[model samples]
Target: MTKILGISAFYHDSAAAIIIDGKIIAAAQEERFSRKKHDPKYPYNAIEFVLNFAKVKLSEIDHIVFFEKPFLKFERILETYVAMAPRGFLQFSKAMPSWLREKLFQKKMLFNLLKKNDINFNEISKISFSEHHLSHAASAFFPSPFEEAIVLTADGVGEWATTTVAVGKKNSLKIKKEIHFPHSLGLLYSAFTYYTGFKVNSGEYKLMGLAPYGDPKYIDLIQKNLIHIKDDGSFRLNQDYFNYTTGLSMTNKKFHNLFGQNPRDSKKDKITQFHMDIASSIQKVTEDIMIKICRSLRKEFNIPNLCLAGGVALNCVANGKILKEKIFENIWIQPAAGDAGGSLGAALAFWYLELNKDREVTNKDRMNGSYLGPSFGNEEIKNKLNNLGAKFEILEEDVLIEKTADDLSKGNAVGWFQGRMEFGPRALGGRSILGDPRSSIMQKNLNLKVKYRESFRPFAPSILRDNVNDWFELNEDSPYMLLVANIKKEKQKQMTEDEKKLFGIEKLNIKRSEIPAVTHVDYSARIQTVSSDTNKKYYDLIKKFKDKTNCPVIVNTSFNVRGEPIVNTPEDAFNCFMGTELDNLVIGNCYLIKKYQNPALKKDYTKNFELD
Candidate 1:
């Protein structure tokens, strides 16, 4: 058996993954264990976790692969600075010292870091490098169920390539086309995110959520001044309006002037109609570009399946638009499509491309529902709860599901920590905060009291796979919650003339559907279809809820407050339950109610972490 370790570090969302003979064994992110949001360190804790989980010594591993080529990235930076010389001196001078000292000699630095894991591990030749875009493409196509597919990857500049097209057949994958740096759709969307007073990488989703509340009033302005798109879906950015290449900020003075205002200060200024319209315009542009690209790719390749990866693919609204166009017979997106999934991709690329192995396609794909993180047994949960002075009661599996379903019917917010912790951004019932989807005020209450996020932010629905078509317009499987679709016509409530006339957040309180908690202001929902094969406990809980309320959907959000990483252990779960307004705590087979716990354990969670 060949044991290979893959690592992606020195970038946002550092992670580690281990594969044994082409089978994915373990994978996890460093932020979950370090308690930092988007931690970009060496992923020491993540490496330790994967090694321990696989019960293998680092010395015994046959190969170690880093996600990207550092020298290639350095070359892009040097060339970009030279092309815009004297204009980027400030940024160039600041970046030079780090590149010369550490990044330029990544192999030696990596060797030192590996020694910290095991002193006996000293094979420097075992370490190899994979290209950034190739890592992303492999992550998307290798795990998909399709025997052949066209792979599309787009993101903020990686090394030099920002967007790429690859074709994957059986075990062989090859890049066919490339769109290089300084012309990126991901960075374009992020520029709007920064202009709207939100953090760049972390707040792009917030911009997507705010799009439905406003009109696309700036689309023409954006098209004329910011980006130029061709009929074949190839595009370039007007650098005169942007500053990402040579400055610290994303947008420049020309960008602000064209938009008719300066960037909003998130600390002071409020989100008005102007900001909402900006978000709407950018979102529409992104979706249109994605659809055009998909159409062109299908027409050119004549492939029935398409796979997507990279940060831009995380835009579920764009993904839904592609699905609605029927450009391909099927679509598969990487669950961890960001920089974190690069670790897995690096490992898979070596197994199939480097070693020349045969690929075995599975009916359900090979990700195992992305439940590749740590899991605790009943005894571990019991011991940890006791040590934390948590008050709880243990129940049988059937009784536990029934009682949890009963609490949802009573409109109680629940902190559910079950089975294995999920590997990606979305919490697929593994570590989630669930509520009744039928409650009209559940969305508002959870946003303010529990998540402490913006009121306009939307929640996703976790519906049973068999009943997804009955409640939502989508008939395809969306286990990763990466696709957006509208609620069924029969389940929607028609808005009155007065309600329809209301603008901005004025329409927030009006119930738009039978499951108002999960429905966005535009009557659309980010959907997650739960199947018994992937997660039996979550499926059974929803089934029990359906038995009592005749509703097969529930509101599912990550089990964390704003700006914090999801909980990874029993103690983290207890602390979050005590800090937030969640009413019930269900970890493993143990259950705890807030009223039964000591009042002294309550905490001020609002200011616990920096807001994203």
Candidate 2:
């Protein structure tokens, strides 16, 4: 029963993960439970959930690993504030109290929290801290199906390094070069995200999504005014026009004046073409910088495979561009590329570096397909269905697959809850909203009817693993949906002159693929391939759907609507189904009919008594 617990807290996207004898048992982000976008408070709630889910006492844990060394990160923070003295005075002043109480005293904080959980730090034996990018590197590489590969991690700032290049072989990883902080590609994207009237960390994806709608009108502006790139693939920011260090925003008044407007305040103004163009320009800049860095990393490492992590790796747009160029023979991205994935990385680093465990790189990546969250057993699900007074059927395995496939083909959006929940941001089939993408109106229907999300947001395609190359331009695997790929020539729908002339986000209605709902305005799709080897249930269901409909892909989105985190428990899943227009929800073997759901018998539905 040897087990290790890895934790990432205080920093945003706080999470906890448990690995029992080298197998990932449980992992989840705090945001799912807390309902915060990036809950950064110590992952007390998440840790409790993981410990209870694994049914292990804290005393049974062999080791505890923190994601990043506190002192090292504190040093970076201090040095940065000192170097850019008085520039970020207001923010610095606001942050000082928290730093003193939380950051500087983290070791004591960790000790107290662990002690409170009845885990004797003395008997717990080993405790260690991983370098930030090292954790990111380990998270991507150790789980990848590669004996050796080039590793690249890029984020806003981790300690001093914003980006790092390394070579990972078997159980060992060696850092080759690191591009330090304040010159981060991520911050550049965030700065523009803020400038374009979107939240910094949360809004980067919106920018990426908006890129297809507008022209890259500010690419030259960003290149010339915002950043300075050297030949060595390192770049520096012209801090004068930025305010992240001191001011409330990533962009300053001068930056706004240069752009001919102040930052668009989201609470006040409507999103316009100007904002879209800015998002487009910044996203293109990010992709360009990433390509440049990838080229340099390839030349330096000369490895055929690449492992990508850090928060920016979640940018499916950039991941797609990198794939199109074929710089790396293969790529594997961390499903939780943000701070939450850091927990898994830190745990693996402890396993290999501290425990000195032997590593195995298999033909399939050692991720268990990222289904590391808590799952409902048949008993638990059946009890909930009975309690809710819902009519349901417990079908046999083959029957379940066939019926689910038939429902999907008929355009019923089913909440496919099976196995453990997913650990990452994306719902990788288990906690997913499933629909037939071949329906031309399915995208809008899912947006306005099923999921009740933004109309502009696109759904991701879950294709059978073997059919990746036939439908997409990609020859590589994307089991995590962290990478985007172009629709194959044969899969694309013919465009009329009217469709070609469609401008702005209105172009979203243009058909690009046999499955138009998942295809983006740019003719690319964030594709997740299902493999029976990893998740047999999801794989079999997709296979059955393809057998029935002859389409290898289906629409897969998180099982929750916009502004809410993905459903974390059976109750959450059921409540979301009842609130939204979801046609069906399967929990374990019990299929719940939302139409027959009785609200009074349930604890509560959050959507009730609320006006949108």
**Maximum-TM-score candidate:** 1
* Predicted candidate 1 versus true structure: per-residue lDDT over 292-376, tens digit per residue: 8889999999999999999998999999989988999999999999999999999999999999889998778788899989999
TM-score of each: 0.99, 0.95
**Top lDDT model:** 1
Clashing residue pairs in candidate 1 (N, C-alpha, C atoms within 3 angstroms)? none
* lDDT, model 2, position 304: 91
lDDT of 2 at 264: 81
Question: What global local distance difference test value does model 1 have?
Answer: 0.94
For candidate 1, the C-alpha RMSD (Å) to the true structure equals 0.7
Candidate 2: list runs displaced more than 4 Å. 52-55, 119-126, 599-612
Model 2 worst lDDT window (10 residues):
603-612
Q: Which parts of model 1 are misplaced by more than 4 Å?
A: none
**Clashes found in each candidate (C-alpha, N, C closer than 3 A):** 0, 2
